[model samples]
Target chain A: MQGTQQPTPQPTAYPATDRTVPTRSADRASYDKEIVHAILDEACVCHLGFVRDGAPVVLPTLFGRVGERLYVHGSTGSRPLRMTGQADPGLPVCLTVTHVDALILARSGFHHSMNYRSVVVHGTAYDVTDPQEKFLALDALVDQVVAGRSKDSRPANKKELAATAVIRLDLDAVSAKIRTGGVNDEPEDLDLPHWAGVVPLRKGYETPVADPLLAPGTELPDYLRAL
Target chain B: MQGTQQPTPQPTAYPATDRTVPTRSADRASYDKEIVHAILDEACVCHLGFVRDGAPVVLPTLFGRVGERLYVHGSTGSRPLRMTGQADPGLPVCLTVTHVDALILARSGFHHSMNYRSVVVHGTAYDVTDPQEKFLALDALVDQVVAGRSKDSRPANKKELAATAVIRLDLDAVSAKIRTGGVNDEPEDLDLPHWAGVVPLRKGYETPVADPLLAPGTELPDYLRAL
Candidate 1:
């Protein structure tokens, strides 16, 4: 895992060790590293937000976390990448990942909501300029998508790495919020003529489909079997 | 569905109504209504983007779809609501929803990606001012979460509706991109010793749990049972 580093300027009052800082809304916020990592690891897509042309741009991009740091890669000429590189003060960004665990159907429509675990990280993103760090960051990203993947696959060559730019955003000012279980139905609606409960949602992997052009007798890896 | 309407300005060259949209790069850009609706309907949360104090703010919020319009409701005092109402020419906004279908694990790290369906709508959102339309819009939002739910549940009181503000963003500049099925392994990696394929993701519902305070003899609704 690359790009994972401890936070700088640990607060004297809070003195957080990792990406754990309690929010004003203590009920909905979690500072536990395990809770934060679990939510990020389970989510496959991340909504990356950055300012572009004085307006907010939120794009769905694939991301992977390496401990305390998050890595997002994009084309070298992409709008946000260019903006980040040009901004004198660095580009402010909010990267978020959410997993929908279930849909809560309540007796009352007003109370209907989804059971979700989401992490919202607010900070400044700077372009990773160091070649050695960039290469490791890209590999961390690939491994994030599929665990133990970077080692098993070929690393990016110099030309390929040059073509892709990785942006590093430290995991500071981060907060994770989760809502789970059944709906919080009003007492009166409990007796109402409606079904009330949660519909669970899950993500599963299917049997591996070797590429059509795959050479015969190439065995499946243990990682794919575990999934 | 209240906010599901495709915006009025039609793209001159619409893709054929048939389902043969290619799975690769071509279909990555689609203005099809079916594709847009399917992606939006299946998703429970949307990334709402707006400009605040000249800086971009992107937040994940609940949304619902009507015939041609997408309805998003929030606290009347929220920044997005205030920005849209106060701006001289309204706020430029982007609302996106994505459903991750699978994780594609390729033999090469560079090729690993996700199979997902996503919709991005670019437009200027306006506040819903008309009282009658506001009521209907609120109903549409409720129904969007659960079909036939509005009729079965109680409607919002005048005060509650007044406290909530609903913004309408037409699907005029809407586009949906979907990537499905297995990984696109590099030909050179065909003989590589790694498993390569996709793990399918599914969302399902569990049996209803009656509210803890449910009165005796409350019957479950058929709609929930069907789910």
Candidate 2:
């Protein structure tokens, strides 16, 4: 009976908007949905920007993506969450996540740069009010930390759920800017007797430190072992 | 004659203002100058937020810090850099850097969190015009990527300087927030059959990849070897 509904067709790219397009280095920007999702999913934290008192405020927080929507959660008393609930038109925000891949050392100071992949999303975030959607978002947030984490852990109770506030931002206006490969030094400076190359930076996970209070019978989960 | 001048006394902590204070998790926020500086120095990129057309925009950019000011440089045609030059009273901005040290998996989904250190600076940014200060800031920016890098590379020429725009923001309004240690699972859920611990994340520099056009005699610098 459930098979009668048609699955929504997914678009390959996000349409470029005035805000998503870069004023400089336009060649580095990509509106491809795959690139945007890959960059977002690889990072654990995002810097969220919102306007307060006619000034911009940027805060770093954990975020999770489900399909085309990104969810950020915090305590009910948090400033941005409370503002999102009170604002009728939703709170306008810009969320960005960046991963610095390599340090680009050029022959000249002017060309020194960092190779990075970053995604910036400009949209209005609305408070998630529906209980079903709220629970789903919460699960996605947990699983974002480690795959299959939501099912392995005990779910939130009524009181804990009431204390949290979740905000959802649709990924409509988004772009991924990437700087890869080696440094681009001027042709004249190529012969300069200075070291020019890329110092690659990689993120690795060390051994997990288990809590002292962990139950004796509890074993390390398979999902974490895979990580 | 310069020795007779009094040395500027450094304060141990940054002065907290209304905006730097968080509504929730007040205990996790700190105003110590040393803590703020350590977090900033360890980060390679910062998310710079500014208001444009009455909406918030956050962009990831490379930055450098001197004694009391932070410098961010970009092409003269970049959006924020151009706006800083044109704004009379300077552009109000928020710059934030974050380091995710570990991932905390709790026995319950409600307690999942990340161990992170983040610094948030809110101030007005002005364009740097003086040639001497501009050069100093540019040197600092290069050294921020690699210690002693500016001395190794060719200095920027007049034409290069003309095409670059540098913005200065004072480190006046700032706060650092940190979360460390193990997860805090509910007492009732402590016996749950789930693994709870912290997965430590470390950043490492791999073997330097040299450019094919590098001069034959050029060698990897000692500073990079130290990394």
Candidate 3:
């Protein structure tokens, strides 16, 4: 259900278009959908924030995106999920994902920084009532965690679906900001007696272990093997 | 200045405490200052959420904490910083830090999960005005990244401090939630043909690089060497 519509788009307190200044490098500024989606897809966790009774609440949750819509799932009894269905007004939410690439260990502490890519999406989310859409969204949520693995797993039963709540928010207002490369130190700091440069960081998956009770002769799936 | 003090805390539409269920391993649930501070220090980035014009906004930024207070710095012109001073109700903010320790590659896709540690703090943040306190907070922030490197680098000058806005939020209302180890698949799924176990993830700092313009004869500091 839609709430009262605004005649004109009100300026957000922190508008990406207005505040984004490409001081060091202009190429890092990206509004491309591909870049945004790629960054989001690689991230496994998201921080979802919203206001409730005039107080701000932020929670870490799992999320997946289908096309241009993001779906977040939780127990049907979730307060946020129930709040979305309230008759008064839809709940405004901000969801964010970040991937830390490396740590810039500058010659000087003042220049120390991090190389990361982050995406922030701001919109109002509403509970999904349609069973078909809910099913699809649930599938998308699973697939987001491990590509193609959802198809290999058993689908949720009617009871499971009934107990889960999914909310969808369109990616209408989205922005991605990134910082990369080694530390940017002051020109004079070059002569400083300190180590300077990026200490690259990465996320790697170790060898997978078979479940303790897994049946013999069951081999690891190709999709997971690739990871 | 403290705003109107409500006699009783109003019920939030989406109360975090209601949905926050501690895992079976309750020992992992910590409200200790040391635990909270260590997790916050190791993290290079944080998600900051606040309400702007009746909507929620989340942004990713670098942060550092000292003692029981977290300090976040940004350009003086940043919208969120300005909102702290102008918002009628002050700026209710949520700051969260998360670290993904490993990827649980389960035999069943449904059981796959991640090992992570996340801390969330909810409170109203205000701009730091005392110059002495601001300086110490900034140093603590720098020390958070590399223990003894703050004293080795040039501190922010008066002009730099004036151009930057620092906001401090106490660690009073805070919670840390963690999930670790392998999948919790259904008993029936034990016989399923799939591999299950955690693929541990790690973060390490690479060897430091000297700045291009470092003065001749400058030796690497012990702190940088240790990292």
Clashes of each: 16, 0, 9
**Each model's TM-score, in the order given?**
0.85, 0.96, 0.85
Clashing pairs in 3: A107-A196, A190-B213, A190-B214, A191-B214, A191-B215, A196-B209, B107-B194, B107-B195, B107-B196
Cα lDDT, all candidates: 0.73, 0.92, 0.74
DockQ of 3: 0.38
By TM-score, how accurate is candidate 3? 0.85
**Fnat by candidate, in order:** 0.56, 0.96, 0.60
Best-to-worst ranking by lDDT: 2, 3, 1
Ten residues in a row with the worst lDDT in model 3 chain B?
Answer: B11-20
> Which is the better candidate, 2 or 3, if ranked by TM-score?
2
lDDT of 3 by residue, A77-166 (tens): 766776887363677898988887777766555566778898888788988889999888878877887788677666677777887888
Question: What would the per-residue lDDT of candidate 2 be over residues B134-221, giving only the tens digit for each residue?
Answer: 9999998998888799999999999999999999999999999999889999899989889999999977788899999999988888
lDDT string, candidate 2, A82-194, tens digits: 89884478999999999999999999999999999999999999999888888999998998888789999988889989999999999999999999999899999999999
DockQ of each: 0.45, 0.88, 0.38
lDDT of 3 at A204: 61
> In candidate 3, residue B44 scores what lDDT?
56
Global local distance difference test of model 2: 0.92
lDDT of 2 at B24: 78
